[model samples]
Target: MTRESSNPKPSPNDKIYGITNIKSYVPLLLDLDRLNYDSWKELFKTHYIGYKWLYGTLTQSVLQSILKPNATAADVWKTIEDLFHENKETEAMELDDELRSITIGDSTVMEYCTRIKSISDLLANIGSPVLERNLVIYAINGLSHKFTHVVTTIRHQKPFPTFLEMRSMLTLEERSMAKDHSRHVQASHQDNASSPTILTTEYQNRPSHYRLNNTRGRGGGRNQRGGSRGGQNGGRGGVR
Candidate 1:
């Protein structure tokens, strides 16, 4: 019969204690890379320009204050440092760069990363508003009622009766958006069929323009960077 000891220390190398046990960190980073690249690819194809914003010191510093148990930057920093075994300050300059290269292969990943980071910083300064929240603002400005009338007539139904109903309904504004998007898709299809397609993105790579062009003596247009990302629409046309 032995009494339980009160003073027990945990092992430093325990699975839950050390950063080395964080087997999923690298995987999470990979997943983020894939998601970001896919999103960039689709946006590029759609001719969407990216932008960014930045967070102010006070609002961002206070962001953790309303958490369930309450928190501070110090607390959050400690968590990162303890889990990653490094100084978190060195991690957050209020800005960090992590962007991938475009598949065009003309731009360096770092140059594009700088632009993406600038856009992110811009978003931070604006304190992003949840999209639906702005509907009321639109309503106050009269745009909502105009669309509401258009939608009711098209659908042969009553105006938006409840927010829940709005969730599944395609209102007039949405219809217009869909119509515009469909037109763009049709236009691109026509353009691609026509050939000499100057394309964009970081997706499942189409194909390299040429491998070892100097050795192979291939012919092609040279992009602005003098890096060989130029070629025919559906051919092997990428040079690094």
Candidate 2:
């Protein structure tokens, strides 16, 4: 007892002795759905160097998934890494599918292009950036049927347009379509204004035969008036 050394070895469980729940110390939770693994990892890196501390930061589902009997901290850490790695692939594919499935219905050209660019940016964050050319194609593919001509022009161009160029071209095409539609509406209105205004009730109630006979009667009356005026002029000339 008198030969005890001044320096003593620390117990293996020294780090975990006072810790009851690891999660209470951590400020945030790890959520796969929100894609916050990066933040969760950064916060977790500060605490205990091993994976056991991660059990506190993780959600119940994540904790349950990595839990194993007699599993070491290293084993748990590897499992977490593997799960996130697999998740990245699955997320990338799902994002790519979302990109391909987008449509430009009821959205302006700028809005549609911005939406696509946003998705591409997200993909890049996940280490799966979409090629610029493919992005252009994706934007073109999502345009409405009315933009078929613009899509064709973009596809046929040599040295395909950049994403910004494509967006500008689509915006111009949208304006052109809007102008054409406006002009067509104005022309339609003008035609309506110039046309005869038939009373709906009278038109619906009158028979075809009655309208025909009325038109003929009006023509006969005009002819009779002209004959009477002519005869009166001839009589005046004879007297002269």
Candidate 3:
């Protein structure tokens, strides 16, 4: 058999890093390093594959800044690490600010929660992990005011809600509130459509002469009482 057919070609999928998942790409690089250590040729081939993956995934600006004419995989990996590692603090702070400023406005409970968790993951990767309790607090604080009742109820309960518990409760509560609001709006529209005609019809059905008489009777009752009091005062003056 020919040595040319000794080894199978690497898969095309293996030529790409995690793409949007840079965190996973680092560990994969480490595993590749360990596996190829026994042979320089295999190691060089692995590095070349990694370089290709990195080149394909990186933006044009990033490629221009970091690309070396004859760079190995290790060289590309080290350059990426150095560039990102130097700005760890800045990255962490930005993540922290994002977490702090996140709100449930215009986003569903699930979306808001996902964003919070994403920021938390980024912070952890940057070495400034948020504690579970603090994360829970941040997530709750970012909720819309409609959740205040649910939040207050949860806080008052013993053993306080876990992050998962809070998330579940908030999601359920959001759905419930949405349903209630929809029902209320539908009912209001129905009431408006049906009630206005009934009210107008009732008013129109009443005799106009009867309404005039009723209005005059109420006014005359007040005027008659005043005149009676004045007549009694005049009678008392005459008796004096």
Candidate 4:
């Protein structure tokens, strides 16, 4: 009966004003334990400027806990923040314990250091970043006994090297140790090649043909000597 309003409300399907299929935009489901909060927050913040559309990205459990029919985006986001941020201290402690116990065991130096860096990154993500000095110390502590000398050298430096520098020094030291081991093995082989004891062992280990030929030669000599003695005895008997 009345004239239509000048500015009608935009439909939910309006291209610029509406968000369709939030799951397509933000694929990650928010978990209760907050392990993925940082990543989930970044994606959610990027896709939608509005908060109402966030419910679809949460797990059913998280959704039931945070959802209310009258709740606004800010309310839900604050609830999420409270749930995730409150446990940062506990998470940091657990991560610190993990970093402390990491070891180099059969892993190469690169792999060992990469593991330390990964844990450090996770700590940083949780707002409990490890200092560079402490990171280096953690890495050095985890090394196997073979790196003891390098570890001592690293600790003794006036200004401790960066983790990368320390890793480089250790890599070089490992190469040097390998080279020295190779040289020692070669020298041992040379020494064994020239040693009388080793040569005797080698002689005894020679093929059966070589031993058999030598034994045949010795047997011939003994037989010839016995024949000479028998001929001499025959001559003596004739003289008698």
lDDT of 3 by residue, 38-109 (tens): 132333343345577566545555567678988998898677667656767887787788888778899988
Candidate 1's displacement at residue 139, Å, is: 7.7
TM-score of each: 0.20, 0.51, 0.57, 0.59
Q: Report residue 49 deviation for candidate 2 (angstroms).
A: 14
Specify the highest-TM-score model's number: 4
Task: Show pairs that collide, candidate 3.
Answer: none
Q: Give the clash count for each candidate.
A: 19, 0, 0, 0
Q: Which predicted model would earn the best lDDT?
A: 4
* RMSD, one per candidate, in order: 28.5, 9.6, 12.9, 6.5
lDDT of each: 0.34, 0.81, 0.72, 0.83
Candidate 1's error at 138, in angstroms?
3.0
Better of 2 and 3 by lDDT: 2
lDDT of 1 by residue, 142-229 (tens): 2234345544543444443332233324344456666889999999988777323343343224446544554345333333324533
| Ten residues in sequence with the least summed lDDT for candidate 2 | 193-202
**Least well predicted 10-residue stretch by lDDT in candidate 4:** 11-20
